[model samples]
Target: MKHGALLRKISVVGVSAACCIALVGCGGTNYGYTGGVAATVNGAEIQEDTITKYIQDFRTSSDLTSDDDWGNWMKENSFDPATVRDQVIDYYVENELKKQACDEKGITVEQSQVDDEINNMKANYDSDDAWKQALSSAGLTEDQYRESVEAGLLDEALEDAVAGDAATADDSKVLDMLNTYYTMFNGAKKSSHILFASGDTEKAQEVLDQINAGTLDFAEAAKQYSTDTASAADGGNVGWDAINSFVTDYTDALDGLSVGQVSGLVTSDYGIHIIKCTDEFTCDGKATSLSAYPQEFVDYISNIVKDQSKSTAYSNWFNDYKAQADIQNNDMPENVPYNLDMTKYDNSDSSSDNSDGSSNGASADTNADASATEDSSESSNEKSSDSENSGQ
Candidate 1:
């Protein structure tokens, strides 16, 4: 994770409630407010000061210091100033809602947990000054940041309590998950291809004819004639992968072939190809009994399933609670410092310039972006052990 993105992640900690609001339109009346309150959730007033501080924190952490920087950042993220204000307010409202729900369930964060979390966060930076600078940039004092961490811990406790047994992968659940993985990996096919340049079908066919007549070995033909140098060196062997991973024409040719069968001329966006199914595996039924799979792989997949189950459980609980909560997002005040004037910031030069010059930066949307970030992180982590053999 980037250092800058950490604050954004922190800012949107209890966003599941915000997602509920976005999916099923905001409930309760929008009783416009005055005198510095931004919103109210179940009679708990969310102060405008709090919202301003958070917005400023977000701006500072994101390095949107200059007016141009702010404009460019907003434009790049497809956000209008008003929408940014609303999103900040929505974050607080949702957080308050989570706090209230947690409070109702008697969930609490211990001081030790808060301290440990702060220590962990501080460890991410090089020195105490750097950590303090990060906090200052996010417009948070040590006490204020501690409070935020406590709130986060409470949210976690609430989720764990609600998820209960569903969050745990026992022996039975692990077995079921193993079967699911077996079905996918067991059915995958491995193929080798001798690729030729676009409009070189005649060359591809000539190579195929040589391989068919046994005048030239497939591996030799691939090494000699294949345009895809990466796989060509490995006897044109693209390791086992899902069918959908290949281009349409390549998939079609590979799918039609039985194990050890060579395909006819296959043309795709990459080029023309003569493909051979090098290896294939299929499970008999659902793999009801366990077969020897690496314990590490089994554990990795089990953890993933458990995490997914916890997320689903939390989503369900939050959605239910949000439906019942008497929430109200009062109108933002005109005088708040963070209520930027969209007209003053010209975003025409921004890469993501919007023709209409306005966008909905709902807090819920951040959750989706965060998920993408997490998925990208996971992909990077897996990159060392996994690779795709594109026939290009």
Candidate 2:
């Protein structure tokens, strides 16, 4: 559960990045998706294709294609149409999931119970003004943030109802499950590959034609042919990678290419595999890593363990709850990655009052930076500069 590991767990969607940016209100922007599948939960349509679009956008936004098992890495961490759901479900599900679980146990959350929770959360903010500022950064109004806090209480209540003895629960188990669940996740492997889900090499071949024709890009080709689904939308972006970091097919095919070199279509179990040597790096970090993105790696590892150790009871309780729950992912889409577009909400802004009458993560910044410069001229100029520097 290191931040390095969580790096893969992160949605690389361009739209997701936009949303992350949205939370910052750094010259807030409003971005939207022209198309993508809407999200549906229990037969209720959530957002029509908005989920898929967000998933795709988030995947494309991140520059994190670096891994030894790039193909599997992308597959495991494929974007979830959960930008909205992803953000909102924690509150909703934890609320309902907890409510239903607690109702069975006849346990009620008293106003006093919730009051303490709110006060505790407020304390974490240092002061009233500071708390409001933090909420604003997250695009939440005070009321909205409080509702989310209440939902946390509900989630806790439900966990107690179902799992029993909130102490000594299963945080490690959950983190372990998270670590083991996907190749693209914390399991640790990254690769570059081509996808042939088109059932034939025709599409992959077309990519080759483009590369050969000097028009189609290798990273873009990987994005186009990568049947890995999740990373495809990102044009096969692999981040912080090294040699032998990918599948055998990838490493073998890549032997002839130099750094930044893209190869012809090479076939793999997933589909056609293409290798791009974006970089050559060495891994020299310690075994320790953050449970999630190590935006502050040392601090997280240093403090998290002691905090969890003190909450062993809660962790144990969670373990039992998850064990008994009849959780299942039914009706998984064949093109699961297609169900989400990470960028659907990118650079788009929306402001609404939550039940508590507070605004939630709304920004109005529009497409100021969307038009990233073309790679050719910018890349060529940079390369020329590098060569000049080298010669001098």
Candidate 3:
């Protein structure tokens, strides 16, 4: 994801496949290429155009425009075009391998499924123009987009087949898995804070005193005095998230309170805070029988639990294949010329809460570090959403 987040921003249009030849020189030649073969995975040649189209697709999805925009993104992310191309090549190699596995197994994606997916995607836009604009932004033609969707469907199907009965494990097992992931997937709380920050304890105490005496509202105190500028503007509304997303001290204090209840002075590395819980939700630490839930609810959670297996199965297959495959990549230069310095980008604003009630990026829960759980769960959650919404 670290590479993916940055690679999504940088791409080149009209760059020749010969550019790879010129850039890598002779030491990196692979598969004895004569026809712009970017790499070969298990004797299957991944064409240069394949990686190029993917680059363009990434560019479009990120809403980056023109050579200048891409150049600026390169400068911002400290990446080179060659490195971006190489990353795409690697991904394409993996994708082709997966496709091959699907083919070898005689797994075929139906035309109706692909058609339904395309229609559903089109419906998300208000007009054909808007849909076209989206495709243009993603550097994809209608046909190419359809191919991508078909590939995605095939990817899902392959994963499902590999993951086997784990998708519909008994309610107790499903619950255990759910309980394991709940801290990551669903252990979130919404709260308003009045963060005093480090060295502001005196002021923090003053604000707390005012709130206790009913003279100053928590929201007013947050806007007027909290040092965390990002959430301070929202009246210290940190939105919803698992408590463990923050430092233990901070989260422990938050965990102790009931909804709508205010806490006394609390301290953390971020500084002191008078805390108040706005909304709270929790899963029982224990898993219950399927009979305890509605059929619809059981079906829904069952789908989510199963979704986790998809990527695992795909990865296991790919890893095994890669271990034995005759892979020859011209993408990697001996010295690896690109300088990828991640600290240059502002990741502070990365958290996004979707209309579908999914929140990603930094937890808006506390203005603390992004949760480790969030990172691991986000991709699987997206996959799950796509699978669920495939025909809608």
The candidate that wins on lDDT is 1
Candidate 2 yields a Cα-based lDDT of: 0.41
Candidate 2 lDDT, 204-256, residue by residue in tens: 67776777788976667665556555555656644322211344555566656
Q: Which segments of candidate 2 are over 4 A away from where they belong? A: 1-95, 120-129, 157-392
Best by TM-score: 1
Q: Mind giving the per-residue lDDT tens digits that candidate 1 earns over 304-391? A: 6676667778888888988898877767667755556666545355433445865423323444334522443353333422113356
Number of the candidate with higher TM-score, 2 or 3:
3
- Candidates 1 and 2 compared by lDDT, better number: 1
Question: Model 3 over residues 1-392: C-alpha lDDT tens digits?
Answer: 32232122222122222111111111133322233667887777776655554445445444444454454455445456776766557556666777778888889899999898778667667698877876665445677566666766786688777766544445775666555555544445667777765787788888888888899998888889877766777788765433223556656777788888888988776677777888765555454655533343345456555555544565666688778878798653333222233343334333232358554221111121233234334543444422112101
* Residue pairs in candidate 3 whose N, alpha carbon or C atoms collide under 3 angstroms: 60-137, 60-138, 187-242, 188-241, 188-242, 189-241
What is candidate 1's TM-score against the reference? Answer: 0.52
Error of 3 at 155 (Å): 1.3
Which ranges in model 1 have alpha carbons more than 4 Å from their true place? 1-35, 60-76, 120-140, 168-290, 338-369, 372-392
Stretch of 10 with least lDDT, candidate 2: 21-30
Q: Model 3, which residues run further than 4 Å from truth?
A: 1-35, 49-72, 75-78, 168-173, 176-299, 331-392
